[model samples]
Structure formats: structure tokens, C-alpha cells
Target: MRASDRAYATLLDEIQSGSLPPGAVLAEVEQASRLGVSRTPLREALGRLGADGLVVQQSPRVTVVADIDAGDIRELFELRRALEETAARLAAVRGDAAAFADLAGEFAAVTLGDADGLDTYYALIARFDAALDAAVANDYLIAALRTVRTHLVRVRRLARDNPQRLAASVAEHRLIASAIGARDADLAAHATHVHLHNALESVLASLGGGTTTGGAITTQGAA
Candidate 1:
């Protein structure tokens, strides 16, 4: 990769992994020198991130990462419920055999799932979910999925670490896959929503008194 691309990726990875945290300021000149890239390409990379809502640049003043809190997570999930349901429904209706195969491929991966530790299951799901997003064939729906995908990344790890949740999640996706395979729009949407709803409740309970960020395990929400 080019120097600027490398710098951009490194910075983005740091931010997403929570190392850089949020609202961290970055300057073009400093980062270019640090990443061993010229200002022009670094600026281009930053511009891309800015469009992705990962960065905010204000002229010559400063650039900083956008930060979202627990409240933001709640909002993000709410949007996910709406947008993802619509996407699932569309996938069920419009998804061809190729889409079914794609969903099935992801469904197969869950059988190898490990509940004890973090795995790339979440990333795999993202790819599966992306298929549905594309199947929606609607720009608005696709755009929303692109936006919400980032916020869901962290919560996905915590949620999947729960043993019961891992199995339940697999079952949920299977149902979604089945519905889509059957070409039943309503069923697909309903299955997806039910899965997400169950997850929200389980996760809220797992999180206890804290936000979805979950500082500790506790008994709360619903059983």
C-alpha cells in the first residue's frame, strides 16, 4: 500500500480498536511526518475517513475523531433494527440463489464458532450482513448499513462471548437464512427483528447497571 494509505489504515485501526479513544485530535503535517507520507495523500486519507464519519476536519484549525457514547449505542441499535430489518426483508424478496448461497456460507461458519473467546465470527457476520445490505438494492438502506456497521463492531464481540448467546445467535441467523432461502420477505424481516430484539434484551441484561459498554456482569433488564 501507499504511505498515505498505510497511515490512514493504521490510524483508523487504532481508533476502532479503542486505542486512540475518541475525539483525539490529529493534524495533517504531524501525521504525514510521523507516517512518512506527504501531506497531500494523508489529507486525502483523512478526507475519506471524514466522509466515513470517523474524522472531522475544520479547515486549518484541527481534525478530530468523532466520538459516540452509550447513548449513541442505543441510537445505533435502534437504527439497526429499522434498517437491517428492511434490508433482510428485501433480501428475502429480491435475493437470488447467489444470495442464498452467500447466507448459507456464513451460516456454515457459525458451526465452527467458539463461545469462550473472541473470534472473527463478527467479521464473518459483517460479510454475511453485507450480502443482505447489497441485496436490499436501495441506496438509502445500503447507506444506513454502512454507517451502523462501525458502531456494532465492539458490541458484537461482547455479545458473542456469551455461550448461550453464541448458540442463540447461530439459530437466529439460520432462521434468517431459511426465510431468505424460502423467498419470504415477511418471514425474513420478522426473523431478523426477533433475533435482534432477543439480542438487545440479553445484552442489556448482561450489561447490568452500566451502559452497553458493560463494565461488569450483573443481573438486570430481563432474563
Candidate 2:
């Protein structure tokens, strides 16, 4: 990978993992040296991040990670609902029934026990997402979903493991997959909506009721 891509990937991972929490300042010189990259490449990486809405420029020489809150989460879910429900409906119409049936079986078999277990569950979800994308076969729709997923990684970090939520999510995904396999467009869309609603509520509750734009923004000094 190019130096800038390397930097961007590293920084993106850090940001999503909460190592570089919301509002964290990413000084050009400091990050460049830390990542062993020169200023030019670091700047390029920051520019890309800014474009992704993961960071924002405060002034000529200042930038910081963007803030996220309950309001932002709600907006994100709104978009998610539209995209995912459409994807599910399309998948129900165009997807391979046998493939989706297999996926539903996998979801039924998932058991989130430890960290490794949760990782496995997430990997399964990724597979489901990939299948949905492939089934839809619409470049524009897939692109929009990708953008939503980028922010979703960071949003997911706000919530810890709730066994009940995880279990419910598994059942919801299973139902969605089964509905698609059955070619039930209406059921697939409704299942996706219910899953998102429950997910949003769970994430907000995890944030001690809800988050705001209050503490997620910080300004850095311009050089």
C-alpha cells in the first residue's frame, strides 16, 4: 500500500477502536513521526479522513476527529433503515434461496460466548452483508451502504456486550435470512426495520440514556 493509505488505515483502525476517542487531536507532526511517515503523506491521509466525515478541519492548520451522539446515531439509523430495507427487499427477489437458507442456518448456530465468539458472530454478520450486497447487484446502493458501515464501526464501540441484545440480534438476523430465503420481501423488510430499531435503542441505552454533541468535539491550535 502507499504510505498515505497505510497511515489512513492505521488511523482509521485507531479511531474505530476508540484508542483515538472522539474529539482526540491528531497533530500532523506528532502523528507523522509516530506513524513513521512524512508530513505530506500524513496530510493526504488526514484529507481523506476529513472527506469521510471522520475528521473535520477547524481552521487552516487544525483538525480533530468528528463527534457522534444520539442525534447522529438516529440520523444514521434512518439512512440505514432505508438502505438495508431496500437491500433486503431486493435480495428476497433476486437472491439464491439455497444460499440464504444456509446463511440462516449459520445465524441459528451462532453462540456469542467470549471475545472470540463475538468476533465470529461479527464475521458472520459480515458474510450476511456481503451476500446482501451481491444479491442487490446495484453499485449505487452498495456504495451508500459502505458509507453507512464506515461510521457504524465507530458507533458500535459505544456499546458494550449485552447478552440479551446479542441473542436478540442473532434471532433477528436469522429471521431476516430466512425471509429472504423464502422470497418474502415484506417480511424481510419488516425484519430489517425491527432489528435496526432494537439496535438503536440498545446502543442509546448503553450510552447511559443517550449521547449529545456536548463532549465529542475539541479544537486544536493552528500552527
What residue pairs are clashing in model 1? Answer: none
Clashes of each: 0, 0
Tens-place lDDT digits, model 2, residues 103-179: 99999989797658888899999999999999999999999999999999998996777999999999999999999
The candidate scoring highest on TM-score is: 2
* lDDT top scorer: 2
Runs off by more than 4 Å, candidate 1: 1-4, 56-60, 97-109, 112-120, 154-160, 201-223
Residue pairs that clash (backbone atoms under 3 angstroms), model 2:
none
TM-score of 2: 0.92
User: After superposition, which runs of candidate 2 have C-alpha atoms over 4 Å from their true positions?
Assistant: 210-223
Per residue, candidate 1 scores C-alpha lDDT tens digits across 5-98 of 8877888777677666667788778878887899888888888778777777655669987765445556667888888888887788887756
TM-scores for every predicted model: 0.73, 0.92
